[model samples]
Target chain A: MKHLYPIKESKQCELRKASPETIRFLLDYSKSLKIVSSRGLTFESNLN
Target chain B: MELHVDDASLVKNYLNGDEKALECLIARHNQRIFNFIYSKVFDTEITEDLFQETFIKVIRTLKLGKYNEEGKFLPWVMRIAHNLVMDHYRKNNRMPRYEGSEQFHVFAILEDDGVNAEKRLIRDQIESDLGVLVDRLPGEQREVVRMRMYQNMSFKEIAERTGVSINTALGRMRYALINLRKFIEENQIVLTD
Candidate 1:
């Protein structure tokens, strides 16, 4: 009974209510993660 | 001033070494970015993961000054989201590949839900082996496989581009796949990518 749920037709997407705080957190996390992982730097170094 | 600022301007500001500029760009476009990820996964949890992954990659690329300011930023990030979704599927081993006509048909028949995940995993492992076998094909056959399978080109399109007849294009792909399967059986290659 499973089917492909085409997202275009469904209306309950999470984007409508994405908050500013969430955006900031994700951006910060992404930046820090990339810096730490790619440069072999410590998380503490990127946190600042 | 905020209402009039454009994406290119924000990108330039960010590239000029302004951190807040990147934040503003994300806030402006995060909704569309979120929606792009959600559209592919159809699961809130997975969408969240991919959305984050997409931005992480975007931020890294922008920081490296390789974002190509000439291109529109929204579509570029959307392309990132789409690729992240595929990578997610690939990591989960649910990304069905196009090995031949039957595999290409609607992404490998969707695999009956009744088939347990373990069975699907085994089958996918086999398919992955054939994926590696692709590189071993003869020049003409390899071109046909890449064009027809990965690029999703029709035999007619492949024929026109490769300067071969449709029949020849189809023949090459068929032989390529047949040879791959034979090689897999003959060499006991494990499919994993």
Candidate 2:
């Protein structure tokens, strides 16, 4: 019979280890893209 | 900051044909929104995708005069993201699980640590295990966990967003934690304290 593993308990550490810098970077990048996309600017023009 | 642009003003500008105001609003609120979503999904790629989708929805809705300025804008945007996440699960037929309520596993995005391949292998294993565990939660419980942890939404806000009573939202969260605890104990998983 195949053993069924209940969900592991170790996944919580990811929450604590998340750095503010990473959060900020992800947000900024997403926001930049959103702004560009909303303005109907292609990625190439936005880059330049 | 040159001027402290209030959310309402920024929104009003965006609604009144000032598109740059939308950029300012995004710049102002993106970090909190991203962090909120990331906390729930625990996957960088998905979080990034969801973040963009959230703003896109926000733009669409605002254009359609769907957003009410009476409520806080950040929380309102978060509510949209929360709904989208639920929609995502429904479409995929997969439930989300809380990362923190489970065994304690860490993913390090360290630079210049000079860590060997062994450490990286361990990290990969832990992340994989974590992902599987999160995938096993029931849909309702998973939604609660995601909103509470990722979005950092208050019970009241969650209640309002999901259209459930506050007690109902809290009860779901309670059961979610209880079930997660039982799963961990049964599996004999050792979480890092």
* iRMS (Å) per candidate: 3.0, 6.7
Task: List, residue by residue over B136-182, the lDDT tens digit for candidate 2.
Answer: 78888788878997689999999998899999999999988888778
lDDT of 1 by residue, B103-185 (tens): 36665656666868888888887667666788888999999999877899989999999998999998998999899879878
TM-score of each: 0.46, 0.40
Which portions of model 1 show Cα errors greater than 4 Å? A1-21, A30-47, B94-193
Note the DockQ of each predicted structure.
0.23, 0.03
lDDT of each: 0.74, 0.70
Docking class of 1: acceptable
Top TM-score: which candidate number?
1
Task: Identify the candidate with maximal DockQ.
Answer: 1
